[model samples]
Target chain A: MQLLRSYQLLVTWQALRKKAYLPLMMAVQTLFSLGIVLGYPLLFPTLDRTTIYLIATGAPAISMITVGLVALPQTVGEQKTEGSLAYMRSLPVPRLSYLVADLTVWLGIVIPGVVLGVLVGAWRFGLDLQVSPLVVPAMLMVALTATCVGYALASTLPYMLTVIITQAIVVFVFMFSPLTFLPSKLPAWLETIHSILPIQAMGEVTRGTIAPNEFGLPPGAFLVLAVWCVLGFGVTYAAMTRRG
Target chain B: MLLQIEELTKVYRTGTRANDRISLAVGEGEVFGLLGHNGAGKTTLVNQVVGLLRPTSGTIRIDGRDMIADPGLARRLCSFQAQAQVPIDGLTPRQAIDLLGQLRGSSKLEVRRRRERLVDALDLGEWLDIDAARLSGGVKRLVAFAMAAVSPGRVVMLDEPTNDVDPVRRRLLWRQVRTLADHGAAVLLVTHNVIEAERSVDRLAILDQGRVIAEGTSAELKGRLGAALRLELVLSSDSADAPISPFPGSSVSVGNRLMVGIPMDGAGQAVTWAESLQRAGAIEEFTLGPATLEDVYVALVGGVETGPAELEEARSATAA
Candidate 1:
């Protein structure tokens, strides 16, 4: 526990000390999220209940996705290339504890943007947000799962390959995945996969919290996110602890 | 013993043996140097000992704990400075050192004390507040060393710690290395700087092709060359010779430099012969000294210090 605390302090200080990169990355995340919220409204000018729910909930989910799929992996890959990863590995700190610390910093950076997105969507589109009690917990789950998956990819793959994979994920998440749209719009095959994938589940959980009953929030969505969380953490831990 | 490696062997997936049946032990307060040329398996051996690489066959014990079975103990007991300059990103030297110390389980006060000492010792006062990335390579190397020394564990492994350092800072670095050993830490220094090794190492092992060719104190190893000395004579020209084997041994010519190996008994004859050559304008400048770690390394590793031609000349001289 002490080691974890030290890692938390170390990671926080490390991120805070990066005078330029931290703020730049955070700005990109916030603006990207705001862009999604504002741009989607333009596409659906005729206000409807479904569009409003999608904009508010989907905006937050997009922030999580951007952080998880882009910013986190890039930072990790840069560290790996620069030998900081080896420095971290040489320390006596627990491997999982380092991951927890890293997740905390990243989640801290992205959560503000998530809250802002929710607020902007509610204010701009007049979303009658029910704001379920589970919103914070659901948001935490989304952030954790996304960060873990990114960490797993960053730690396990070569830097160049990780970059390529991250780019691919960005394209898939924004253009193909049904995170912001109805599942009926996706082809049967892709929707079948998204049913089990965490992206759509993240949107469903977030949407269910704010617009409960209007959009189906199957208990199974929470189950899917939980399973993904377990899988991500499991793979990341195994990768970090694996012997030569 | 603070650290021990028994019959350690590492065979990569490509079937290249990096360390072959290597065995050694370092006691507390001992600074053991590992000397080798590039691809001599020095780094491989250190990596295995630090738990960064898994040996195919061997047992590594750190503070008497099995490293492979208990890597956590190894991590806690070893502080390593890798060959590459530590990438500090944007953290100042002070922050980096403190963070590493705390991560290594040092107390706040202890970390602060050590950080101050290191910063002072390494002359980091000017660069202490500057970000590591903006610092010069030599400064970065010093900061990395400081990070390693902040809270040294029972075993400290430093790989090429003085690579980019200046001569003045290099001296200070050597003192810090000795200080670590004096504090009862087992220091493993892997470097190609045999000259520095003579001053800093209590004992050393010279590795070649994944095997230890020689291991002993500086005196003991040089003793193997027994009254044998190295003569580095820069010839005025590579022309007419004046009894090339002046002292009854081979004298090989490497470019304009002719290196001759001589025994104590043959010193007079060799000096006389070189003087005659000098008079004849065949020799320009010359130096004679006791055999160095470089000489022993060249003799054992073969052609490491000198080129292929020099090795051939030395081989024929010995044979003759």
Candidate 2:
């Protein structure tokens, strides 16, 4: 594990050496999150308290989801196409260290977006009155789960196909998913579908912190999210450990 | 033996037998060359030795440790310089060397010492700080070579190490390889460059289509031609149709040139025959020299005159 952490630190340093890209990406994430949370309220000024509360908390969840489902997969796929993945495989380090280090760097990049989105939402909407202790842990789980799923997708598919699939996923999450809006707004049958998807469960947990009384998630939400986390990590591990 | 491989075979799922039953051994402080044309299974054999691919059969023992049972031992014992350069996009040459060395379990002090030595030897001082992506292909290959050599290992496998290197730098690279061997590391050099193999390898194996055709020291392989000397000639346009043999052995055509082996007894007649052909305007150019490693390679892998019956018939006809 010490060797794993050392390798993680080394990889992180090499990856983040160009400081220009990190801040630029952070700015994009912050603005994109702000756009969904603060922009939606401007378009629907007459929305009631619960709908506004859902958007405020769901905005951060969206930021995490986008990073995981789109950015992570795209970056991983690029590494594969560039032969960096093969180079890493040639190293003498432990096989599991690659995953642990890669996830660490990406998670580091993603978790801040969740924080910025949550803080920006609270500042933009003056409605947050209480904060739960579960917010940090919940957000971390969501980001990790999403990133793992993206990594699995990147490994399972070729680069071009991964790119197209990740793009479709980003578009669906941004436009069609009930992440930033109430599930009641969707048709009755569609609501049944989101109940099982990890995205809705993620949003509920994220929202629970901002509006504990009104939008708090039940224990079943965490359980469903945990199941997704286990499945996602299992796939990513299998992909990393696969030998040619 | 520093590295011993026995009956290694790799049968791909597509039914392509990349590496047939092959065996080889390399001792400490020896530079062993694997010579072959493309798709001759040199890389496949190297990959299995390095633990990148599992052998369908046989055993690879490095320093008396079985690599199959403990793949990590292969990593610990051998460092490989692959044919394709490792992608070093964002990192500089120095960082790449340092990172790989450290990842290979070199301490920081050891890494720094090796890095300084390798950078100096490879003449990469100017480009060490530049982004590797911006460097030339040859420079990247040199950096990759440095990365492979920086760590401590008993065996070093260099696959086509001189592909993109300039002549001067290539000489320097061979010097480093020799120095590494002098320091008691067993080096496996996989290349198709016959000239480099002749110059650098202490002993070598010529692989053709996943099988070893010949294995010996350069002098020994060259000596396979016995007392025969090669007499090469470029025939004039008018004389091209007529066979030009100073002393009849089988002549092999390479482009418009005809190369024939002369018995040591017939070698004295070569200069007289060349003079006669020159005066008659039948020959444009000619040279007579002892058979070289290339000659042996041509005879073996090129399949021009490898048969015992053809050799005996050619000798008897020449004697007649």
Candidate 3:
């Protein structure tokens, strides 16, 4: 509960939203739903709409991962710049508890971005996200895993350079990850690499839930995701707790 | 003891000792001044007292609770208003005060009743809805102090409380501080502003390089330096130079206004000198006065002296 309403996180969220990052991403999401979603079926009348629906439902997996990798670092970097990090430590709460609140707030924000992406995919592509309700928890697990991975990278990098590296990684992983197209479309070696990447797990999980037959992810994606979550948590927690 | 420090020592990582075996105690109803130069461990001492930093080897107790063993309990008894503004940029002034009070365990009714007076006194009606980042520097400072005083912890440690405040409001702030102390809160003020120190603090501890060089009333500290007399002189007019030569060794000029200094006295000579200056018309409008905190501050630390007049000069210089 303390982690939910921390002063720094609230202020940081306001600052981030005002930066036009969230609004701009949201705008793109709305367009994706309205244009490619409805316009695609209208433009290609001969194309089968079920597969198109499947593609639309899963297409945003890559974009969500891209935004997550790039935008999440701004959260931690803003805290450092605002001087509230030191002030927060000055309070009576245990250092770890305060940091946990920061992590929780950033993780919370990712939910909206991911959900918006998925919702637009559903509404525009004309395919129902036909996964079991159980997939909601499974999808959350993938988001949590991606969150930790992004947090680790952000915390370890310097504030000025955080944006650059995060943007680069977002682009790098979005290009190669197997969630967008079929895994068999990739060369066999690249297919192995995609299984372990943070974004790849989310992509695979979303595609598997939405269209399990054509875009089946390997069973080991979950194992790779768990490993990423644990390692990311360890690295980021160490970075936040290091002595000022 | 409202506050206690025993052999408080804070040594920086590079081996320079910021605080060196300092110890002091302030009972309730006391406004204690911690005076020091920029690197004189004033803030380091304040930080430990407020639990922002731990003593390298010493212990701090607030309201008799060991600060380290149960820090949350200790925090209940004390609040720290730091020199740097604690940035609560998105919060409006009214919300900021209420939030601070709530965080410190004040009841909703208590916060509701207390916040109105604070809002009015701080003249924050205009800023009550504006976020802190949008307010001016002085306004943010007022908010910080108001937040520290919302519940009036048993001990409130203020580091340079008057920074970014105008002179008219500084007096108002000191009055508020006195009211808090009179109500039984132990107030610790850390500052380099000797004028503010002279006029406000009931007791002062001059800290030199992390050690208490002297601790007493302003009069006691000045009296120790040597024989001193309070010299007072009225201005001939708003603009005439009030002869200040007769009062030797110290002077403070508030404006084209009164000048006074308690000169060092060895067997009452400072008095005789004041009379002599009176006779010579150097101080045509003259009376002997008491020594001040500025005098004590200069004697303890080697530097060019500052009185209200010099401060006036410095202010004009910056303006020019």
TM-score of the first chain in candidate 2 relative to the native first chain: 0.91
Task: Indicate whether candidate 2 or candidate 3 has the larger lDDT.
Answer: 2
Point to the candidate with the largest DockQ: 1
Model 2 bad stretches (over 4 Å) = A1-9, A12-24, A27-31, A34-59, A119-131, A184-193, A210-214, B225-290, B303-320
Residues A68-181 of candidate 2 have per-residue lDDT tens digits of 889888877876665556556556666567677777777888888887887887787776558787877878888888988888888777778888888898887877788888
Task: Quote model 3's TM-score.
Answer: 0.73
DockQ of each: 0.25, 0.19, 0.15
- Model 1 per-residue lDDT tens digits across residues A96-147: 7777777778777777777877877777776667787888898898888888
Each candidate's TM vs. the true structure?
0.88, 0.84, 0.73
Better of 1 and 2 by DockQ: 1
What is the alpha-carbon lDDT of model 3 when measured against the actual structure? 0.66
lDDT of 1 at A107: 79
Query: Which residue segments of model 3 deviate by more than 4 Å?
Result: A1-70, A92-97, A119-128, A146-171, A174-197, A210-214, A217-220, A223-244, B49-52, B69-72, B208-211, B227-290, B303-320
lDDT of 3 by residue, B1-320 (tens): 67888888877554667788888888899999988877677877775665555568887888677886565555567876877776576667777777667666677689868878777766667888887778888888888888888877899888888888887777777887887899899999888898888888888898876688899998788777663655555554433565545444555565444444544443266557656655765555655555666766766775533323223222221221
Residue pair clashes in candidate 2: none
